[model samples]
Target: MKLDVNALGTFYRMAREGAGLAAGRLTHMTEVETQVGVTKLNFMRGREIRRDFEDATEKVAVRVKLTGAIEGYSMVVFERENALRVVETLLADSDSETDIDVDAGEFDEMTQSAVTEVGHIMNSGFIDGWADVLETVIDVSTPEFVEGVTAEPFFGEVDETPDEDDLALLFQSSIETVGTEIGFSHYLFPKRESMAALLDRLRTSGGIEYDKLDGFDRMAERGAEEVAKTATTLTGIDTSVEIRRLNFVSLEAIPEQVADETLVGVAFEFDGMPSGYLLFLFDEESAHEIVDAMVPMEVDEDGFGEMGTSAIKELGNIMASGFLDGWANVLDTTIDHSTPEFIHDMGAAAVDPVIIQLGENQEFAFVFDTVVMADGREFDCEVYAIPDENDLERALNNLDVDRIEETPTTAEFQELENS
Candidate 1:
């Protein structure tokens, strides 16, 4: 069972199309405007996945077992409040004289029934989209409802508590109702062999070994961890990686997904076997906080003026080295990055140059999507690492999967002279 960029791109498109259909169905049923949000494939360890679901906020998920073309589980998860809001809309359309208090924690038979219907329709739309792409039929089972403040309800259904090394293939699709502002997560989990067969059928190029996927996961995990460590060491803020995902998307879709308002960003172009651009973006407030944390004394600067910009660029330079070093160690190759390029403008404007440079060569990119944040502080940073398609394919092909696990991730930190 091997995988390639083309196969993964097809999977991404299939999921996106399904998400749109699901949104359409929701609009028709609830009579509320709806839309599909970010759709990406997530490769996470069992430990990371468990940590993600334990946010202390109650959640409701509709789980269905799949057989036929796809074999595994499909889950639709919603926050407790969002589920209540959606149920309210479904109940409003019914000819019932009774009004249930959703906030009172009373989900009776009728509410459960409505949620089930929503879950069923959503699953069908998603599976139908995939079927249309693969030209196969997938059978879905009865929907089962699970709700809890902890991860027990969901984890209990799974075979067992998976260890950290166990990798899970999770496809995430978010759907939001415009009027109610309700958001829900849809996940598709297919069996290993089934996924391998699907990939084999969809793959166009000579796919890399399936085991090589492990190298991709390790590099991303190590890079994200190093960036967080570098940020904390430089700014003295205890920052940590929140979410890290490998996304394949079009160059045109890149700018559209970024924040619309002005952002403080640090951009870099790295030259290596898989040469490409890397960017670290932060909100205006977060940038200010980092500047303040680095410079003890408050300067009388309006926006990020000379002193502030310098601080950001220096941080970016060191962080860039650390990030690339992680990859260099993984691939057993040297990756040199250019000097940090400071960007203070709208988010779309920051990425326009990179898009233009890469747009001529390829349509899609393998983007490392990561978020680093600190608890109880404004230290949020979004990291995007886009690699060249041909070069990346070449690098991945040369990767020695056996050595990745034993190789240590070390950041080459250099001292910056203060002017």
Candidate 2:
């Protein structure tokens, strides 16, 4: 989104006034240099935004390309003084320290006042007007919005767009991809007997409950569906979906970043989809046990195998495809998806923001804990959704498992018959 010019000016003005008040106390430095430096910084910040957002390298030319005329308003005297005090406090400990002996209480009060003033400025009608303009720009840039909403309804009215039917197909495709690529055959809907068995084993060994597993499974299915829908709308891909469960414990002993504790993930996927995979991962230890069980590797391995990265990527690809596909089906459109990316050792850190950005302008989050077990090892799983909790819940409730008939047991049975 483009920065609000008026808002930007207001921020700079407030900052400058604050600097000036603080500069009043400085006897050692030249006022001209400080003021010039502040102005330069403001100009540079604007230029930086333009360069990043608009790719305009001619800094001087871009600076003069104002969207609207600048207002001729003088700085508020009280606000200027407060701004100065704040600037003084910030630069107090700098190597090029100012000679201002600021009163701590007075500085705090003035700074608070200055902040309040800026807040008010942001909430003013001018900012609201700018926000409306920005929202329109964003909607125009996104093709789905343009196609889904008529220009009049899109620009003049905001209404809920009904869900489409293809969304479920996209989700199913993502699930199939993830299941095949990551060896997470248990991740698909209807809770395959093998997956149920795995869950039961984890619960029996780790004392986790069936309800928790059911909840996790439900959430994973829902996440896959929502992701599919989002991907379809955002990227025009109808087969990108992701299933994630967080804060899960691995049931088997394995390698860890620390000595023992870590997180686990389980994912699924589908076919004929863009970015063609759905994936989930667990803590290092949990992954190790899973890998051991899935492949013919010995159980004493210290680290994930060379196939681990590919496995993770395949999983991500499937999930992304599922979500995109689901979204496309719902929107009656198509979307393209990119190859999946995976990062292991993301322990206890803040969730990635890019994932959340997929659902633009919609406030969405996922909050749930699940467990993972393999070969008698246990781990915790936490889940996060792209938009809001309700969306995730709705997607899960609407998931259609019958759309994809291939399950681990059925596949195995087919293999036996073929043999």
Candidate 3:
């Protein structure tokens, strides 16, 4: 079936509102603000899922099966660090941290109970809102707390169909609670037939219009220019950031673009309008060239070493700040970036952590691709940004809302995939 744009927009709005309710419930339970970021509806094919999760770090997943009407699944997925923070917040009065072993795949009973409650509230908030909006009934199974590294069959595998024709609605939300920001991708992995039914319901329901993404694309282009300017300044060479693409795409589809290639990845979290993640990608040659420029090394190096990585990290910090500064100036909001983390690995492994964390709450990520040129020599690079709904909306609001256009064509996504 061809994707229905109107139905998809309606679904996005419903999911966003539903996730907001879930965040509210969480805030009540933890006495901390549980802000819900924007939500995304991902159309995922089953065959490519393993590759999607292969190197993704494991997290604690609380899954609740759906039995009535919409037959599928709903769950809240959390990274280990956030999971630990949640457990600690839940047992603030008591010293559960001292008694429980904080293994990656294992949690103590008390921690399990707390995380389960979180799952329960999150799942209910999402499904209940969906049910009310669709005017349907959905019975939730008992919330199950399972801890693992990947969403494989052993963890929280919701997709039973493996064929490319089968589509799953992976609705995700960026959740902030207990002084931590984690993602909660609540998946509705209905069978093909069931998905058709849900889409039918959406078609009949009044659709909610979402803001267009073109403005952000333009903003990203400007940010890329700023980054290039920074590189030129630091290196005292003619440097430029050539924007290859600026688009939002499914998290799974992202790695497919740069997969198998060895890359230099630098990432950092930022605190701003809605909080976001910024990543810088570079090929080995590009990384070395940039590092050499940043540090002005005497000996030409073909391989990236510890010192080179540190120099690149510093450059990443500088470039990221320059890019974010443009956003801050345009949006008239303060954007603060954290320290950068550097990694040299295969494309999949390098991006897995950031992609997994951001993907947990939303299936789509805003990828800004750029190729750097230093002294007329081209270098491949990318800067991917995943901002929550709140920030996206705020950023869009700062622009001409009247210019919000229809959703970009599938051809645009295809370009990212094929790029």
Best by TM-score: 1
Q: Write the per-residue lDDT of candidate 3 for residues 272-373, one digit (tens) a residue.
A: 874787888888878777776667557555577777878888888998898888666545577899999988888777666777887666655555565566
Give TM per candidate. 0.86, 0.26, 0.50
| Candidate 1 lDDT by residue in tens digits, 1-419 | 67777887777777777777877887787776777654456655565556657878788888888788877777888878877787776556553654646867667876777777887888887887778877889888888988887777876766534445444555555555545445666766667777777878888988777667667766776787789889999999998784355667767778877888899999999999779999999999999999998887878899999999999999988888888888887888988999998999999999989988998988788787778889899987888889888888888889997797686644221111101
Candidate that scores best on lDDT: 1
Error of 1 at 263 (Å): 0.9
Candidate 3: lDDT over CA atoms? 0.64
- Where model 2 places Cα greater than 4 Å from the true spot, the runs are 1-281, 298-301, 319-332, 355-383, 387-419
Better of 1 and 2 by TM-score: 1
Name the TM-score of candidate 1: 0.86
lDDT of each: 0.77, 0.29, 0.64
lDDT of 2 by residue, 242-360 (tens): 23222211111011212233444433322221112233445665455435434444444345445655543444455455545544453233556545445554543223333333235
* Candidate with more favorable, higher TM-score: 2 or 3: 3
Q: Cα RMSD (Å) per model? A: 5.4, 23.2, 14.4
